[model samples]
Target: MESQQSAGSNMDNGYVSGDNEAQMLSSGAKRGGWITFFFVSATLTGLMIAGWGWLTNLIVYLIEEFNVESIDATQIANVVNGSINMIPIIGAVLADSFLGSFHVVSISSGFSLLGMVLLTLTATLSSLRPQQCETGSSFCHGPSKLQSASLYAGITMASIGLGVVRFTLATLGANQFDNPKDQGIFFNWFFFTFYAACVISSLVIVYVQDSISWGLGFGLCAAANFIGLIIFLLGNRFYRHDKPQGSPFTSLARVIVAAVQKRNILLPSESKDYYHEQDGTSKTVATTPKRSFRFLNRAALKTEGDIHSDGSIAKSRRICTVQQVEDLKTLIRIFPVWASTVFLATPIAIQTNMTVLQALAMDRHLGPNFKIPAGSIVVVVLISTAIFIALLDRFLFPTWQKLTGRSITPLQRIGIGHVFNIMSMAISALVESRRLKIAHDHHLQEQQGAIVPMLSLWLFPQLVIVGIGEAFHFPGNVSLYYQEFPVSMKSTATAMISIVVGIAFYVSTALVDLIRNVTRWLPADINDGRLDNLYWTFVVLGLLNFGYYLVCAKLYKYQNPEEEVER
Candidate 1:
């Protein structure tokens, strides 16, 4: 009867222990599977379209509307990008610790709607923005303090809404599946949908913003945000909601505190000397803590007065379970792998911002009448990434596995991504060098805002390369973290990728500032500056970072080797 009840409990929770694949399959279909996937994907599409509509054209908006300097506009864009990525960690913590994913996502969507409305208002009201500079005029007025404050307030609210919802929604979607394979498939499709929505926004909404009207463009984003929130709420019945566990960080902290307090205690040679929790009771086990980070093992040491008469720990701060100690140790072990990705992301962040600036100075004419929007140029990357993710998941990975008799591991995928990134940087430098040559030949260097006699098509190859690289590493990083992190931190695990991207964008901002201050490589006018040299410098950095990643990957050991093999 207890066994039947346990099986029923597992069904309710959408997870089954052991080899109950048949039961999981049926229950998963009812709870999550393809039914919930459609709703989640639709919600993601609407939200992402709203997000990309404002974000893609921000640098141009800053320069044209506010009269901010070109470099300063890029810096501000970088900061905004960084903030958008960084804020997700906070949302993830909130989701995993207190408010559940559905609540967080719903609240964030409202914030997004409010933000987009304010942006639309700013675009509509001339008083909210400075006067547009006349053609061929040297003097341009900057935005007033009121204008800046209103703009920033809108940006802040929108960023919080967008960033918070980004990965929390992904987590919510993944929670529907009981099978790891389904979860993996969901992640791939989630990113594919994400990039596809961005591509649409870049082409359609961005065109509206540039060619039609900014007010209308922003109003559309607000509408999309509202629609997305409604769709998400509507799907609440089908969604499998996970209850928020207490903050996992507290357990991590307890491990450190307990270890420090027991610093003077002698190391135990027997497994019985350490405390282990089993079925909410202290139990003796044959398994001793691993030798690595031996000091942390002391946290689980059975000390006098550490336990109560009922076998529970009297003070959690002074004694943690072995599992708690191991969880902290897992994070420590993965730190180097995570650190390496930060450098990897920094170059990509720099490239994303730089590409927009590059497009502005190049000939963006497609045929005769339709000129490509400078901000929309990065859509090439999104389109490429989305296409390749579909191909890789549908064909490439399957073929590779069949031929090799093993699946492509996440580390291997990341390594391949590194190689492609390096190639992209080199290609970017070469392309920039040719563009500079064309600019010099035409003597366009002396003129500010001069378009180089070079086609914007030249930029596509490098962007496409970087996009392919992203298709590998972005999903790989998310998969790795999700698989390896403590079960209690599943939401935080997914958000770790966002944290990496956030730090990289901030680093990219600092790196750009450093370059501007130290070298003449990046000036306001790209035609007059050595933009090729900056790309070359990134190439060198990429090679060095790749080497560091290789070392880290080699040294790293998987916590669940069997699971990796199954993948």
Candidate 2:
């Protein structure tokens, strides 16, 4: 008879031996320091994300040449962000269940490379056909619909490929360090390196966007992505690949079928653990357990803390509901925390959109002699903010955590981030209020010309505060969702972080539109043409977000599910 491993035991009976079980995780750790490996991997991946931040800055400059309004650009951004995030859910499911992370990462990287190649072609060739686009634009206007469609198609493919790899790689990189004792510091380095990548990309890509041609900027982004893929591929020899565990969907189906047979319950009264049957090497379900209504604990009926006989506790068997089994297939238990994450992301989206508007409205000294390319400033500010945050996290947060009784949990950081984000928006509102006063005094039709040049400098504090908020929120949210969720649903946890951004985009868009509509009801001079009112809306949003943070802080608590204790 084959000996089976006892349930809940960490021992490696499923594997051939103890050494073989060690192969399951950190196989490469034997050859190198786990911390060094994770830090290196995290830095490489961080550079990839930084490239994206730079590209986000570059795209606005590109769109301006097209003369597209802020609304259309925002819509395109939201669509791209949402579609990429949603598609990754499928990619993660596949990686966790069937293809394995190695296959998923490799194939996804290939698709990313292909997409980048096509994007470069689109950028370089569009300038060749000026007649096809609108007036004042270098490219064609009407007849290039087919070309536009092709570019969008390429973007879709690239988004899916890069996005899937981004989701998988971070977790894979974290896996490089098997020592849970240092996992926090490992992840801190991971977050730091990722932001460092953004910092480097911001500095370099800004030059490509402004000093070089538009074609060159897109081309450079494509090249950077390819470089990222190459680095990942070359480093594969230093990595461990987890074997596929089978499809979550297939497991869910089996659970449902078994639940039906067991009279609609998970882990029937007599069944305390899961089991599988195998004739060859394939996995199949054994006979379902029968249900029995034997109370394991009657503490609810007893007053105070009266205890039952310890032997009686062993006699009574506990049964799990079908809902609990379904939950096992997903990371849905983290949904409450995920819901709070959306609030955090809303400010991030606003920083990109509303912050840009505020910057543009500020006084400018362009005066024909000096011109500030919107692209350069945005990249520099964002990269600087990310770098500063990394430094604080590395040097500051830990020290503070040690001094205080409580370590900075994800929820606490997120709550604290909202405070800074709210202040940033409030600062914007104050800047706009001053700008409006100057406009009204001059009786100018447009404040762009009348507003003081120093107003742009005022927005700097807002950007820096926003950056400070990003430090606390973005990576904290990532590490939090990943650590809290069940191991089986790790990839889903990554995607959940993205979903927060996706939802926040639409929410911010709707709020902006609603505020504009509501303000339109006032006289033209009082509302329609008044940009100052727009800042007020952001101010309101900031205040509401702050209040929301307070509620979340109150509700949020961490628990170690495996240990069954409050952390």
Candidate 3:
């Protein structure tokens, strides 16, 4: 009876016990340290500062130092950004499927450090970069093949490092906590630290690069990367490392194959006809598959030859359990909501790059002493995002819960983000309209590279609004994916957002190129082009995407509804 009782609990929850559970539990003084958060956060902060230090100023660096053309610089930046966001999927795959988060992060940080060092060398060694190209030069000198190779090698390494660090760091930090509330708190602080790092990099690091020396700026990044890597290594003992269970993706694929193979065979309705396993030794879940996605249920069907002489599942590599089949169904059901986020992210990606271009053309003065760096302007979005994240996490959520007697769901948070994003794009359109009007008044349409009398501050409201939109959507999408995704693919859940952003950026590049070719809306000289039209296009896209999101959200059923809560 004692064994039966224990087995019964196992059959239902499937929660692993013994050392797996023990390793995760927060113990006494020796185990979890508040200082652990400080060390890891510090490490991550250092890496973030190092990363953005160079990246934010990449456009300027390419044009000034590498002597690349403006359109070419923009294309390179988009591709680099896309690559940075895109490869996190590979990192997440490594984390969830094989190497685990800690090892991958450590290895990637090393790569980041090396990249930073290389970039520092590139900045210091004049031969590694092209001669300074004046803005009005008839023919600007481009980077030589050797210089280009060296430059690209460094960029590639840094991008790889950033891809690994992005979501894997979140997964690592969250692993430190067992309680859901603690996990939430960690996420809040995690993103805050991330944004805070970006803010400092934008203001301080970017200022140094623009106003001071690029060599010094690049060297500082190298130093930060070194310190961060060292600190992360030092705190290795304190981390509650989660081990990777062999790839869930492979198992999911196997289920599809098995189901297809068994498609002609009718799915068994009888409870006993399905394989119910408590350690594969006892029954659970009534041995019946859920009715939804019934085609997949065939994978879980038990046949006479499938079991061994002692009732064990023989050669089980080709077959799947009912839970596995259901897990696949959950992914299938959630895919529409997942797909919707790609379009949701597309406008933001385009706007981010375009806003930088807009800043370059506007008067960027704060009093007589200082000129605001063009790269730093987008930090407005980061600042707004950081502020709203704190407000939503600290105040808004609790208040909403108290008034409603229930927390807001991720879906609801995402829905709110869609509205704010639309508002942001509309505001962007209006601001661009004003800037274009000023250009027309000054008769500067034909003047290539003309700085309109319009204050760069005019661009602030749109950025801030988008920042607010990001504050909602970024966390909402991450939280939703983390909650809805299977346990084995938790790292991948975070990476899914990166995946969308990556694809969106690529899409944005295509759109930008298409616009340049087909419409007069985006020419080499943005001052002469109709950027307002582009923003309006995004507004229309946002509305359509929002509508699609609602339909998907309405139709979807949560696999584990109880776990998804706002608070």
Candidate 4:
């Protein structure tokens, strides 16, 4: 009787049948249990701790072990950061279009674990790294091309895995539940897990790296990655796997092609004239085309050769559904706001890369027993963001909703983030100005690699402000894109932020290079250079970006305003 019921259910998803039916259903029925969360979350937490352990302190590793210059190290770190975030778009595409999330994630995790092992070897084996350079020396023995390749190979492999899992996990985890409310809760919890894991990575892993040996620190990372991958594999029996439906990007492309091909054709006044969306071949009758973007409605206009004897498209070449046209229009409409994120992200990226260098050149001691590692300073931003998110979710948004009888919209939240981002840059400029003044008073310019008298903690306020800004914008941007984008493009929507961060980091790198070539503001030794001027430049750029964002935000309208609320 159980096997019979399982067979009936199997017809719905159409996975397997006959002899394997009972076996498959036994596991498949357990997919959505609360117990599955432990396996998935544990895997996620372990992977994050491992990845962040190495990634968070990348600059320090490059500068100290690889003998890279401070400015050069920051550039390298920025590139790595960009690559890690950028790779997720590819993972999301693969998950949504080709191989399902489980396969891609599992394969990616294997690569990640392998990379961690290789990186640990680099730390453990002296041959993998260049000799450390003496401080204040005019020269540095940077890693040889061969040695660099090995180190980078590991970093690249790890980054590829990290990137693939970043956005895909959310979708995979959400699939375990059918309830929309449960999905929302999962998304929030997922983000919280990442933040919490990074905090652990920063405090514990960074401490080990700084206070102990690099090999030991990376060895821990390798162990965690291995454990995470194992846990994920073990949970395979409890996963609800989605079948790949080919890339939705292709459908979007079809809409454009169809619309352009039929541009000269006139749209009929009757809604009955258009071909509404048809799922598979159930022939559930087409609905009327939406009135919006009526010009694109030509794409779905049923001509003589559009339908076959069985009600399928006879020529499946350039025709699209009304839904596809509308989806394309949704993408088109949200593009300006999406484009604005690149500029919005640029200043933040610039600050993050440079601030580590600043901390390295400032007093990093809180007391005789407690000294903060320069690289670990970035974690302050992460900590601040986590705290702010918790507060906003628990109290701030709820209070605001109670007072106004309406929750803050994604755009409105993003607007607030823009304000904070601009303010953060301005504050950074002021802090840098003070650091410069102190550097001058102490005549640290003569000392090539001297630390300024000012405390590195001065950098914290700007980072905290930036964190608050991210708390506003990051979720706002993510939720906005997720809710606004068509169902077919949901995974791609989540991956858009990665695209923004990747592009912004690269742009920040270019801006740094340009600044270095054009002016005396930035030098190999920042003590001899005008670091404050660079911060001021970021402030100006941020202000302009904020203005652009405001313009875009004002013009944008929510596609599903009723469905979204500040949970």
Each candidate's TM vs. the true structure? 0.94, 0.75, 0.93, 0.92
> How well is each residue in 204-261 modelled by candidate 2, as lDDT tens digits?
6655665676567667766766666667666665554445555545544444444444
Candidate whose lDDT is highest: 1
Candidate 1, residues 378-481, lDDT tens digits: the string is 99999999999999999999999899999898888888999999999999999999999999999998988888978999999999999999999999989888
Candidate 2: misplaced stretches above 4 Å?
1-54, 58-62, 127-143, 249-333, 361-371, 439-455, 513-535, 538-557, 561-567
Q: Roughly what TM-score does model 4 have, to 2 decimal places?
A: 0.92
Which pairs of residues clash in candidate 3, taking residues 3 or more apart in a chain or in different chains?
none
lDDT of 3 by residue, 174-290 (tens): 655555566666777788888889898899998998899999998899888889888988887666555677778887887898788788898767877776663366455675888
Among residues 3 or more apart in sequence or in different chains, the pairs in candidate 1 whose N, CA or C atoms overlap within 3 Å are: none
Off by over 4 Å in 3: 1-35, 278-287, 310-312
- Clash number for model 1? 0
lDDT against true structure, model 3: 0.81
RMSD (CA, Å), each prediction? 3.7, 8.1, 3.9, 3.9
Task: Name the weakest run of 10 consecutive residues (lDDT summed) in model 1.
Answer: 1-10
Best TM-score among the predictions, by candidate number: 1
Ranking by TM-score: 1, 3, 4, 2
lDDT of 2 at 158: 78
